[model samples]
Structure formats: C-alpha cells, structure tokens
Target: MQESRLRWYGHIRRRPPDYDSNLALHLSLPSHRSRGRPKTRWKDVVLNDMSEC
Candidate 1:
C-alpha cells in the first residue's frame, strides 16, 4: 500500500488531475457536485508509507 501510494502521488503530480475529471471518474457524478479540500495534506499526500507515519 505504501509503495502504491508513492506511485499514485507521482502519477497525480505528473498529470495533475483536473477537478472535473476526478469527480467524473472517481466520484462518478456530474461536474456540478460540491467540492471540498482534499483529504490528505499535500506533503504527506506525496510521500511514501504515509499512513505508517
């Protein structure tokens, strides 16, 4: 899981997912849905084995 999170952070940073795309694909909802701040802190969100810390 830790390794995967690191890879995912790289992927998201490289591509920098658009909010609309995130909502459509991950949330499976219309673009009009309300949004909130991301769950993870940006630094931890980009790190490896973050949950263990």
Candidate 2:
C-alpha cells in the first residue's frame, strides 16, 4: 500500500504544474462542514506516507 501510494505520488508530481490532477491536488475550497473531524483525503494519505520515508 505504501509502495503504491508513493508510486502514484511520483506520477502526479511529474505532471505539469497546470495539469488537472496535479492542480486539483493543491486546490483549496472554502466551505462549511458539520462539526466533526474531517476525513483523511487521498493527498493527505500520500503526504503522510512521504513524511515517514
């Protein structure tokens, strides 16, 4: 699982800065949500694994 996440991370990183997938990864949207803990996002998973490396 970690290996696959890293592989996909690398693939996304290699994309052009303006690429949809890459851009979306860094997109931020202002919105309201219920009062509760937020779910872990795909980017968050990949980034957390990266920090463990």
Candidate 3:
C-alpha cells in the first residue's frame, strides 16, 4: 500500500497544476516601459467658427 501511494505521488509531481498563472510583472512590463502618450491630430480636434446672425 505504501509503495502504491508513493508511485501516485511521483506521477502527480511530474505534472504541474492545470491552472495557468503568469507573473504580473512579466505581462505588464512592456506597457510600463512604453513611449510617451500619443499626440492628438489636428483632424481630431474640431473647431466652431460659425457665428449667430
């Protein structure tokens, strides 16, 4: 009985947990070290030039 239990333990140890868990720092590192904020284009900012008569 002890031998059988030891075999099961060895088998489980060989296989890791099914749930996937990655380091948060590894995933967010790219965004954290990215360039400055994107600039707004002239076309994106609309101006109101019409005056009421």
Local accuracy by lDDT, each model: 0.54, 0.90, 0.37
Candidate 3, superposed: residue stretches over 4 Å from native: 19-53
Cα TM-score per model:
0.34, 0.83, 0.31
Candidate 2 lDDT over 1-53, as tens digits, reads: 99998998899999999999999989988888868899788988988998999
> Which residue pairs clash in candidate 3?
none
Lowest summed lDDT across 10 adjacent residues in model 1 is found at 21-30
Which whole-number lDDT from 0 to 100 does residue 18 have in model 3?
55
Q: Which candidate leads in lDDT? A: 2
Model 3, residue 28: distance off in Å is 29
lDDT of 1 by residue, 1-53 (tens): 66776766556556646755343334433456347864554455545365666
Identify the superior model by lDDT, candidate 2 or candidate 3.
Answer: 2
Clashes of each: 0, 0, 0
Q: Count residue pairs with overlapping backbones in model 3.
A: 0
Q: Model 2 clash pairs?
A: none
Per-residue error at 33 for model 1, in Å? 23
Candidate 2 colliding pairs, count: 0
Task: Give the Cα-based TM-score of candidate 2 against the true structure.
Answer: 0.83
